[model samples]
Target: MIILQANQLSKAYGAETILSSIKMEIKHRDRVAVVGRNGAGKSTLLKMIAGELPHDGGELIIPNAVSVGYLPQQAVLSSDKSIWDEMLDEFSDLLAIEQRIRLLETKMGSEETLSNEASYNKIMKEYDTLRADFEARNGYQLEADIRGILSGLQFNGFDYYHTTVSSLSGGQKTRLALGKLLLTKPDLLILDEPTNHLDIDTLTWLEGYLQGYPGALLLVSHDRYFLDKIVNQVYEISRTHSQRFSGNYSYYQEQKALQYERDLKEFEKQQSEKHKLEDFVQRNIARASTTKRAQSRQKQLERRDWMDRPDGLEKSVAFTFPTDQVSGHDVLRVRDVTLQYDDQKEPLFPSSSFHIDRGERTALVGPNGVGKTTLLHMLRGQMPPSTGSFQLGSNITLGFYDQEQAQLRSTKTVLQELWDRYPSFDEKDIRTVLGNFLFSGDDCLKIVNTLSGGEKARLALAILMLKKANVLLLDEPTNHLDIDAKEVLEAALSHFSGTILFVSHDRYFMNQIATKVLELLPSGLTTYLGDYDYYLRKKEEEKERLALDALEQPKTDQEDGAQNESKESFEQQKDAKRKKRQQERRMAEIEELMQQTENEINALETALLQPETYEDHEKAHDVQLALQQANQTLEDLLVEWDECSTDNA
Candidate 1:
């Protein structure tokens, strides 16, 4: 069932239209994502759907029974109540229902009501109905639900429950708001930039939780990895229009590229045909013998339908990191490094040791408040470690991209910020570089303080590019960058010859550019040889191993000795031989099945390539479906074959 629908929806501020005639729909249990570049009216459209903002034009149809809970980008919770009580407020209605049930129980137990059959029966019926409703709402497990959500959101600090709502930090308050929203259990849950302050662990937990969520989900987030894992449908708002894709973010990207190519080809074909018609009309109109034919052609041309060109392409900032010099093979070395804010508190990392080789892109990652930024600062010499030391390689020049962009002077204009630092560069050269970062014309005159977070980030990157340092230290470099900018930066960094040590929460970015991952922990730094995905897989394998080990009982010395002595027994040897023969037979069977499935898949693929199959949509679809099923069967057989071969070995 369609819970919400928008028909020609539009929103405007004065004369500037943010969303123009946008149409979209959200069905029951739909995991929909509205994605766009910064300031592309994604949030505005969400607000319109949530009824927080009024639409300038068009109709928004929402079923009256569907309750929507909207958590804006910056949700503020101001209350004198403690965090626990604030969360309890979400269940006020259920609490009231419970109160009525209690009152009914009291009246039902009274002598007057007991003597009255009508009153007692009515009270019993009311109690039964109320009890069922309460159970359906999970009223009895409210505290358990709240606790689970809070733990999943990583609210385990000392002040998690004790702190008052008004006393919490902005990020803490946002988290609390999210917890409350989840507890409310609305039919439709809408979250804007919900992953803004989430760490990797918390993000993983939230992804699992939302995957099992009972209601429809609509979220706007710049976290591509999060979107790919959560959202099944993508509605991209670009160039004042909306386009829908029937798959996850990664699939959407593939389909979008294919659609663009197809549209471009169609456009070129139409243009070629129109030009030929025009040329024929022009040549024949002047000849008296072909005047009637020319006139007919002119009429046809006037009545011809023209296609509108696809216009979603907008200019994006270009980024490149070029080094002026090369550093030694040993880019960085750390030995027994320990970091702590104060002596009274525990150290963030104790006896951490790591090294960054030349041209190695290392990503520092951990849970929030695990001192990723502190470690980066220590490496930059801005903070001194409590113990041990780190040394930079010979002739290593450093360029840093601060997450807060504090290196930028707020008083200076965009043009002056770059030109003032590099006095040797001419004004035109500086402006040209700024323009490359998307600061052109009058935009160069805007003060740094007034610029948006994205603008400040671009300006910082521009300076970093000009620095041409051999060692780049980036702190949350992908923060505040739109998806497009992040992609561009990823490309630039992937091509850079310099060594890099950066801290980021962007798993997708890390997967693209990171050569190694250094996970900072309270215990110490753990290094992974591969990217973020590899790190996660390794961690999961380690977890599984630990869990399996936990399940096994410890053997006594006598039992161990007896088992060791019985290892070469005749019965054991005979059983092992039989098991090995069985494993070998199973492996052979799996291989045979895999080969057969592969052959079937190949046949179907070949049939799909034939003209008769290709021309008929239904036939082609059937062939493709059969090929997919065959491929899946082959994959299963391969897995089984591997397991059997391992057992035999």
Candidate 2:
């Protein structure tokens, strides 16, 4: 069914037109992506479609029962509630049903209810209906569902559930907000730049989740790889007009290129014919015999309709990394380098070792908080590693591109920003570089503080290019760049002769520029001598091998020990076996106890909610005490179980 359809949808801000005429349709479970440049009105169109921003003209149709969930660029969630509680709010109706069922259970068990057939029947009927509704909605797995979403959003630790929304960072809050929205399961999910803060791992996870989602998805994101994986249809908003493409990002690019080429050729052909006609008219108009023919040609030329030139690709940033000097063959080397945080029980990086050769574009990748950027910082001499050492080879000059563009002087103008980097250069030369980076004319006078993220990124690139450093360390270099700018940057980096040790979650960039992949893990660094796709394939193969190896493990009993050995050795082995067996037994015991404790806590909670228990202080207190003890016991069991499992591993 068509959940939404827009015909000639128009939106504007006073005299300025944003979306003049937009047309698109979203059917059941349609994966649609809205793509455009930074200021191309993509967001405005989405806002209009979502009804967050009013439309000035045209029609948008949404079915009465079709629910929509919109996530703006910044998911602003203001709440004092804990993360888990805030998520629980999404299922308030199901929770209400649960409460009603509990009340019915309490009433049905009463002597008065048992003595009255009509009252008992009515309560039982209500309870049956509520229970069926709850079951239909998967109410029995409420906690499990919530846990799955939280973990997928990287809120895995037990304590994260209790962390209030106000305490979370903006990015973390955005993640939490996304998780809460998933729980709501709206019919249509519209997201703006949903992949902004997601790392490669989280991006893949979300991609998988959305692929399996039953609802339609309409999202705007500059992440091309993300768009390629999730979207089947693309709506492009350009020059205040909308065009729909019936394919993913890659397919759209191909079609757009082909169409442009066709239009260009047609225009050139017509111009050639017109030029021939003009030349003939000029040559023959003076001759007496050919005067009629020349006049006829001139009249034909005047009557013919002319086609305007088709627009080409947008002007993108164009600059290359010019190395000042040659570097040694070994650009950088590290041995046993890692960091151990005081708060973390395990070191974030465990004796990780890797090296980058001269001219190698090494792409460093890992999950969030796995210290990819921190490792780059250590290499840049911003800080020392917790242990081990890393060294740069002979005559290596490093240039760093921070994702935040923190190195740029916000007080300076865009023109001054580049000029300040190279004092001896001619002013024209500096301006030329800035102009190549899309800071032409009056744009160069804009203050850095007022520049957008993409503008700041361009300014930073201009400086990095002028620095002429032989080795570059980039952290999320594509952070604020749109798809076009990212492609330009990727091409520039690909052509650079110097070694590149950069961290990026842009999988498309990784695949485009990476000659090698360094996967930073808790255990150590794993090197894949290929692009992102090769790394993924190898990872899957490794996973399958590990699964098979796990199943092939040999099992032995206490009787399988060596029959004859030195007493010391025999006794030590026997004691170790006995301890292992005891730990295993304790694990089984804890599992049983945890289940019992959960049942006890539920029963106690139900009793505490009853009228008889709450009306009497002594009974209420006793039940509450029992519930507390049960909860504490469950917590203890979980900790012990985790330890025993770790020991076994």
Task: Give candidate 1 regions above 4 Å deviation.
Answer: 100-123, 159-161, 556-649
Superposition error at 450 for model 2 (Å): 1.6
CA lDDT of 170 in candidate 1? 81
TM-score of each: 0.84, 0.81
User: RMSD for each model, in Å, please?
Assistant: 8.7, 19.8
Residue 218 of model 1 has an lDDT of 93
Candidate number of the best lDDT: 1
Give lDDT tens digits, candidate 1, residues 298-403.
8888898877676646788897999998999998999998888765578876788999999899999998888899888888889999999999999899998899
Backbone clash tally for model 2? 0
lDDT of 2 by residue, 524-600 (tens): 78999999999999997797577555544553554334222233464576678778878866765675466567657
CA displacement after TM-score superposition, residue 569 of candidate 1 (Å): 28
What lDDT would each prediction earn against the true structure? 0.87, 0.86
